[model samples]
Target: MTRQMIIEPAGQAGLTAERVREVVAAHPAVAAHLGAADPGRLIVGGAAVTGRDAAGDAAGRAPFRASVFDPVANRGVELRGTVAAPERAEVAPSAWRPTPGPDELRAAAQILRADPRFPASGDVVVYQPMPPLADLERPDGTTTRRPTLGLYTPGEDVEHRIVAVDTAAGTVDWSPAGVSPAMHPGDCESHLPEPVESLRDRGGPDAVRLRVLDGGTELWNLIVVRPRASAPQNPGDGSGVELREVRHRGRLVFRQAHVPILNVQYEEDGVTFRDWQNQETRFSATGTDPVGWGWRICTRPPRTILERPDNDAGNFQGVAFHDAGGEVRIVSEIAAGWYRYVSEWRLADDGTVRPRFGFAGVRNPRTCMRHRHHVYWRFDFDVEGSDNDVIEQFDEVAPGVLKATPILRETSRRRRGTARFWQVTDAASGRGYRIVPGGHDNTADPYGIADLWFLRRRASELYDGNPDGDNRAMLDRFVDGEDIGRTNVVVWYAGHFRHDQNAPHPHQGHIVGPNLVPVR
Candidate 1:
């Protein structure tokens, strides 16, 4: 078998696993979670993020798979190693449609340059839409989505913003970071503004447009949007899902629908304890904390890396993987009292994405307790359509053969060992792709259950099994009455790791999440 593309090399100077353990060992209660996994084998926090230089420059020519660890993902990672990207489908987004060319992007930049609200530019960020367009949904049921030109800018003075221009009317809409419909920030992270470092497209022709942004110096997302002429159409009017589909000019950039929702849960004392609550991290391992949603975090400058997979073939003929993500260390009295949140996100040209969470800073000086972190990632798969279902398939081992199929599935947060992998499949077009969890089962925690949970989409199902960012008591609240049979559903994936002492210097942080593959 050909070797898989193992993400390694430092994009910028990275944190050592030993450093991570030092912080993990700070609090006894939190430290006790380590329970002897070996001194230098359990890294508490580090990340594997992608780094892309600005729009121009030879350094930015190809994309790069970056990490906080010098050689990231040398440890935790699970993916079918294939560097070959998909063949550009015969059909494409309309050439006549209003896709943003460099001219539009430059124009947008100039507009921001003169805006009173914009921060003075130092490191400027300009991007081209990968899917090359976006769809926004209206309140009326007639049309569920609208077309628009979507763009990402961190905003002036550290505030965050998303710029979406109505390609039809030439009007623009600006959204501040940390607003509702925005991803929830982690416990230690609620107090800081999310910083978006860069936005770029990978995979050439039919590339996935990825947004690499930072939060309160801690959170970020790998938002993947597939641009095509077949996307749901809109008249730029505020109504209709029933209207005919069109390759309309990019008008609306709708997210809350396409990307999944994810929550990071950390607990110790045998899953009976939790560390975050009420849209904020309740208290620090040091002591009970106070109000802090706008705390200051010193975020380091991002670095870059490059990757050229061994199996590079097809359309990736001579493309070198340029840095296409953002990697920066956000240090606040982050959590566990004094720790750093090394956040990283990588989007490859082959439709593979990784979101890694790493921690540094001071350790808990209290009890040495054992603990685990569970990232309950909620995904709303709007793959060409919002209404889709789950398909659990097994890699049935046989003599020179592998078999797969779908079945009525059940879920539990207290058990393990279910379907090895699954996908968000559209029942209508019989289309959709697989969501494969990386690393091994218990990739997140040995005691966690129902690695993958599927439920029909519901307004009430906005947060994680536990939304308040509260206790593990309400952990499975989202799974109680939800069903996943032939309906628009969200996929919740729990990826975590047990924290003990930090492993050795050369060790890597625990990276867990799914390697998203767009199924043909």
Candidate 2:
């Protein structure tokens, strides 16, 4: 039988009719309640009441006063205590439904498993060549080749080899064949075990050893593991789990090693020198230590060596020195002809050694100037994020100056797809301006080598003196009116070296130049 119900917020005594009507209209069974001819007869409150039907028909309403014995203070105010007119009652279809059973859920899962579109596990290995280098292109658009040291996977199980390619003949050559233990390529699946202690126990002591052979020398090394012990668990089933302890130890040894260049050359009674490669040399005194010094031969008069005050000087790329009593010892290796002197000494009987001193200068070669020439530009980017996505295409703004577009990405809290822009203009003339957008943020991706051709034209117009000096002036002009502290300008530089060939090393002459541009 259909029934109309009204529920409302209870007041001190009961609910008002207006609140009852608002509640009934918003109820899930609102349609049925509206169809009733005498909704007022369904009054719900803490006191009994009588009311008429919607058709103005007089009807006796069931008294619904809350019982004094009821534990709840106003039980009669609940919708359960309400009733509609007799004529409004009508049998209706059942709308209640039950939840899905276990069988149904299992069947749904099985269907999903059978679908071909379901995801499955697969492995992919990204192989990047070792010791990356850049290839240069000639004016004719022809590319010149550079030696790439090929791939060398240190911890892989499969055999590793490099195949040299000859572009002219379109052929390849392989060398230095080697193999590692079994490994599932791409999947990262191997005989390695978790809780390394357990794996070591199962694989035995020698399973994790690494062996290497060079020329006639052979070296073997082992992997070690250690585990912490856990306390005993309680007898009760509710007690937490227990853990085990383990440890590992390994060592490496070189078998039958031969010294390639062990000749020691001595000078007078105070100095001993060793030379390997015409340029690589080492020096030391009879009573001093030479544990970490570079090798160099003394080709000139013996100069007083001084110790460096700062530790940084001794730790420089290829320099090292230490104090030994009254005589200071020095050792250095310079690719180009050069000599470095280090010294340290105590003043008379003051008992204080003057802070160390170090000096480096070039020696005269057979000729005045080296004829070798290489042209290159140094580009620096003052970006905040990853080094890869920072710089954008450089557009020539003038003959030599160029500007790069800044990439910025929309953040989560802000509206999506918003673009970031860099406004560039001449601060003095207020001319030569450009606006570019679509730059990524410093977070997700970083700025790398970006082309800066836009500023070339502007740079040419501003050029009157040195290229670098003029470039700095032009940048200053663009930022004149703007507040430096408040604005964000991602600056970076890039350039290519050509003609001269040299080994890639940290302290190479070409790499030891000023790269950062002062913003002030």
TM-score winner: 1
Local accuracy of candidate 2 as per-residue lDDT tens digits, 1-520: 2111111111121223344444544444433433432334332212222221111323434422121111111011123233343223232322111111122223333433343633342321112121111233459764433221222233444322222222223332233122111212322112111110111111111101121222333321211110000010000000001101101111101110111111111112211111111121122222211222221112232222222221111212222222333222232322111222222211111111121222222211111111111111111111221122222334566777666654343111111223222333223332221223112111111111121222211211111121231112122232223222212232311221111112331222322111111111
Model 1 ranges with Cα > 4 A deviation: 1-322, 325-336, 366-368, 407-418, 440-447, 464-470, 473-475, 480-483, 502-506
Going through the candidates in order, what is the number of backbone clashes in each? Answer: 66, 57
lDDT of 1: 0.32
Clashes of 1: 66
Error of 1 at 208 (Å): 16
lDDT of each: 0.32, 0.22
lDDT of 1 by residue, 1-520 (tens): 3211111111221222344345333423332332333434332222111121212333322221111111111122111111121111111111112223333444555554455654455544332221233334456532111122222233434222345444334344555222213221211111222111122122222112222223322122322212211111110000000101111112111123321222233343232323221011111111111112221121222221101112101121101122323322211111221222222334443344354444332212211233455545555565555545655565536655546665444344322344456766667665566766665325434434446666666654442333343334233565566456666666666666554443322124444546666565
- Candidate 1 — worst ten consecutive residues by lDDT sum? 234-243
> Candidate 2, which segments miss by more than 4 Å at Cα?
1-291, 294-317, 320-333, 336-366, 369-388, 392-512, 517-520
Positional deviation of residue 463's Cα in model 2 after best superposition, in angstroms: 35
